[model samples]
Target: MSDLPSPHDWVKRSAQSLKVERLEAFFSGHAFDAHKHDTYAIGRTLSGVQRFRYRGVSKNSLPGETMILHPDVEHDGHAGSASGFRYQMLYISPALVQQVLHGKPLPFFKDGVSHDPRLSAATAALLNSMEDELDPLEEDDSLYGLVTTLQAVCGYNQAHGTTHDYAAAALAREYIDDCIEQAITLDDLAKCAGRDRWSLSKDFRAYFGTSPHRYMTMRRLDRVKAAVFAGRTLVDASVEAGFFDQSHMTRHFKKAFGISPSRWCLSLGE
Candidate 1:
């Protein structure tokens, strides 16, 4: 067996309301535990070599390579070099992904890792923004661009396959907007606009760049975030946003924005 180093040999810096964290360490170490979240853990290896396990398989991330960890999977992390590992992780919500996809079906990347240049480039832009102060509009524009870019990279073709006769995804989008507080399903979205679930999912992503489920979560987060900005308690915000609880909302909120919603609110002095 390969002997691992100490777990304490690590350093972490983060902005909490958002789920993203910038880590640089010789992590002569390991993760605290094998844990899973309700968000996509997307990140880049900056220096040395980073190693981890996902979906029951071991993987290595070289510098400039992006590591995509789907939410709710058990995984562990460690360094492959004496220099340790350096990386920034963006915890992405399925909902935010859906925003780009509209009400479309979710696209699956068969590989756990990707070197696709489009995804790489778009990811770099957002990761880079972590270092700067951004206005909501500026951030939204960049985020929207990246989301759409990712859909394209994931093989969402606007001109082909599946939804050949569906109406524009606009109706589904409107239904989601109007029914933000209710429980919705793929079948519901398809029925809302007379499209098949798969076609609706496809058009949602083709038009907005993410899946229906993901879009709903993101929209809910937006409300949760808005409530936070307005000074509602986390519990209140979570319930209002349809999250199971504050902890659930916190996980998703941090995943989407890179910091805990509470801390983020504090940072804003609201």
Candidate 2:
């Protein structure tokens, strides 16, 4: 398919969870501006040529190829061919990765695309059907398989000398979850985790793949999304989610998901 019959773009999201967010989307022209996410953006292009810029290099993911974009990496998306692109993406929280890998640094795929059969199979188990809700145990098993496959594909060494305080980071994460609707400071996290602020910040990033503030913001965004999906207005959702206003929440929403809140709601058929 070298040419798209229509130029319309759309996104369809699966059931939302803090551990992962799944979506299938198609775009004919520009898909997204440069943006960064705090979760690993792993996906497979189903048709056409999915193209993006990552690590200062332009890359294309052909049909059935796995694209493993690292957390917090700046990238953008568009169709590499005129047919446009259709794909399914799984945005997994690094905290969940840490649950399986312990305190190790998140697995890295220097090149955004991978051809490993193990990874392809593992991702297919998760992305094969967006319409069906995964059973809780089935979801856990799939995530475990995917994370381990990613580690193997990346050739991560278990003996890398990097040390992370997983306990401290876990404590800090719990505190953030408990206080997500309030202003959170590094000092607050440090006090809760019983670690020094700076060191805890480092540990948090190493274990969670994002800063404390970013994690807190993402959690709040999750709340906003839930509220909006429950029929609350954008302004009300923002306020309830602890953002100053809808515009403030919108900026972070775009930065994290590469789409505005209103656009995202429309994609949900709201």
Candidate 3:
């Protein structure tokens, strides 16, 4: 941990995408305002004791342990020791977790940092090299593993009441694949699956790690990639995958993939 200024104003910045952020402060005497995020804060503390008030319970995370904060949960963070805290965080979306869980309802972890070693290894693998370029196959595999472990380790124990609901999330996954090429709206999808858009969206993100729209973007990217490999132009491939144009595809392509689509396509030639 870097030496924290004795009396500090805490500031954290997103390193690359909103899906993750890096904290580089020792908020020894400072307190974070209570706020909620749209994504899960799944991460590990690098050093010092990271203290936070979560779901009305106080939990302290230290080195070698993982913390999984559910989305929209009220929480606050500060140092739990004199040396302060440094941690790497991945703001996972519910859809991402759901994808790994094989469309199970987003699992609920205990309201604190965890000592589970499986949690550490699984979450670490994806968020560790946030900036490294990933092959498509690697991205899918890693995300699948991460999501599944998170659900298994962190899932709500009282699933008896909502077992049917969880089943719906599973059915939603099958629904999505069949309708991938269609111009499907949230309302349309919810109606088709007998789910509310909000729940469906949450389930989708928890399982897939991206919004339904972005998931579609990725699916389209996959199709575009195959087309490019078969000697199609970017414009044609984009159109074939239901993208507006090459530029529309490019923006999402880079954000979802961490690289330009052209680069990925060129690599096929190589």
Candidate 4:
């Protein structure tokens, strides 16, 4: 219907290694082609009924309900009503979940949807409008809260393992933070933390929710964003931020943030 809002229009926001993909869209009919990705697709229906197929079962996500599609699962989306559906979703990496759970099995929502109030509240914080900007500390708090809520809602109990070396991971994290612009290596991190390379890698993921490389990538991405905000060209920003080229930066930018640098700049309406 001409009067129906087009779902093709959407906006997204994301950062570097944390890679929390946020989207707000309105779909009047069929959406995707039953594809799958390596991130958890969690969302809340904002208006109308969202119908979709998940794990070979037809399901409907009504307003105020949470939709949790696990990583690498096949799914498709469509509107359940003529009125269409508007929603906000966050595509979170399972690695981030592992950070909180310490390498436990990923949580599964059997029905692919839920009415859990804790999930609703937790998702709401991270799934805020695409226009919102979350500072680093605020983002950390929100991410921890969300992952904890998800663990509870999914009925997962974290397994106790050989304790991770927090001191080593923290030292490496600090080193990365200090030398963010340089191309860092696993050996560099291991030496900095006084641990073996593989062990430090595991420890870094356990403590920080991402790999050391991803962490550095995100830090460079932060610099790119700052440069753009301060009125630098994406080209200059990408180079100054330590990317090989604008195209290389663009690829990572889109992959991490779910939007091109040009589109993101336009969203600022400058």
Candidate 5:
């Protein structure tokens, strides 16, 4: 097990892709303001009670229960008990889930917390401990199993909707990867993919789990994280990563990731 940070500490690990962000944290009380991300916040409470508001309902996650917060929903976090709560979490992108489900609407959990044994076991391996180094194959395999388990548990039957243009959306995603530092507009992506802007926008979100702008921002954020890891100052990194300024980068960084840049650096021993 990785050494726990001091009380009220929040520490995150390193992941090369924005598709995944893993962390182990302890919160004495209110940990974050109401915020939403473009990825599912899936985690397990290890000790004490994890309390949060989801879908306008108050929910409590005790140790051994899995908490699944769907993408793009407002939620808040706090420790439910005086002793505080310790937990491990993985922020998984909807695109990753779409890779498995392939055009299905993202699964929804009516309740934010679950005690299902299968779902619990599936996440146990991935969220086993904060320090476990995941090799490429192991990580991919675990992600595959995890998403399938979620689908089964949530009864996601892949309802039929307007068929999405995955190929076009994929082209836009590739273009974003190629021109990460440049300003990219929906029209730009639409031109590249040979699709209508509004149609492409809906297809992109359905296929990739976020809008074109958000996908670009996350890719840029990935670069920012890499730059910061390479000893570049935050200001330099922000500019190099294509943000307007440090504050611009900081705002999206916290919104996408739940932690500030400096704290992320400190947790990484920078």
Candidate 6:
């Protein structure tokens, strides 16, 4: 009859892709150190109290409440009560959100937690159990709904007098995808996009919600994940993914997903 988590902490990762990573985890005490992510972290607490520090304030997300952490924001997490907390989270690349909003600014939730039923409904499909595999179309529809619902909840307004070179950004993104396993630079992306380096950098962020460098890095991480999932050793996978070594890849992996590659693999019982 206790709500407390067991002595051991555990995480279960579901099927993931370059665009989204999903996991369900339980923690009894301190869960994460101060860290920032380049992708939006969105989730719902399933039991007990999920506590975190965001934007200089402490917040708690109870069961059925949604927590939204914007990209590149510093935060830390822990359980707010003796009972600990269990939650399901999805890390979504900003580029996917751009696919729906088309170069708009990413939505922000100042409070870091939401009690809105609409947001919960929108995330339901994508937040299903780790054992369930979402159909491709179903996932896409859920993503669209989530993005639009976020905008609605935030009262998003279209900014005027701002323009982005979507063509250039798209060209740069394509080049990154094609050469993800190679060393890339701003100059390289600029040439590929037919624009100057600085301007292209700005445009890339405007359209994709992240810098060209970050985008390339995430793509490389995606490669690393795939190779590892296919049974390759960490060193081999890191090298094949264009990382200098396993340690190099591990740092980025932890920052991006809040868990190391080894832990992530173990979570899936692999």
Best candidate, lDDT: 2
- Kindly list the per-residue Cα lDDT of model 3 for residues 1-270, writing each as its tens digit: 122223443434333332334333345543454555545778888778888888998889888998888765668777788777877776565655554555455677766688888888877776565546545576567667766776677655643544335555556656666777678788876776788989878666655444666656666776787688688999999988888889998876655533466555543432
Error at 20, model 6, angstroms: 3.1
True-structure RMSD for candidate 4: 6.4
Report the poorest 10 consecutive residues by lDDT, candidate 5. 1-10
TM-score of 1: 0.54
Deviation in angstroms for 113 in model 4?
4.6
* RMSD of candidates 1 onward, in order: 7.2, 3.5, 10.4, 6.4, 3.8, 4.0
Q: Show model 5 residue runs off by greater than 4 Å.
A: 1-19, 157-161
| TM-score of candidate 6 to 2 decimals | 0.88
Give me the overall lDDT of model 2.
Answer: 0.87
**Local distance difference test, each candidate:** 0.65, 0.87, 0.65, 0.75, 0.81, 0.83
How much is the lDDT of residue 40 in candidate 4?
Answer: 76
Off by over 4 Å in 4: 1-43, 48-62, 67-85, 89-113, 125-148, 154-162
Assess the local accuracy of residue 136 in candidate 4 as a C-alpha lDDT between 0 and 100.
74
Q: Write the per-residue lDDT of candidate 6 for residues 124-236, one digit (tens) a residue.
A: 77897568778888889999999999999998654687666888988999999898888888989998899999889888876666788877777788888788779998899
Q: Which model, 3 or 6, shows the larger TM-score?
A: 6
Superposition error at 218 for model 2 (Å): 0.8
lDDT of the structure predicted as candidate 3 = 0.65
Q: For every model shown, what is its TM-score relative to the native structure?
A: 0.54, 0.92, 0.54, 0.63, 0.87, 0.88
State residue 79's C-alpha deviation in candidate 4, in Å. Answer: 7.4
Q: Which ranges in model 3 have alpha carbons more than 4 Å from their true place?
A: 1-28, 130-136, 155-270
Better of 2 and 5 by TM-score: 2
What's the distance in Å from true for residue 83, model 5?
A: 0.9
Candidate 4, which ten residues in sequence have the lowest lDDT sum?
1-10
lDDT tens digits by residue: candidate 2, 22-60: 899889888877888888999999999998999999999
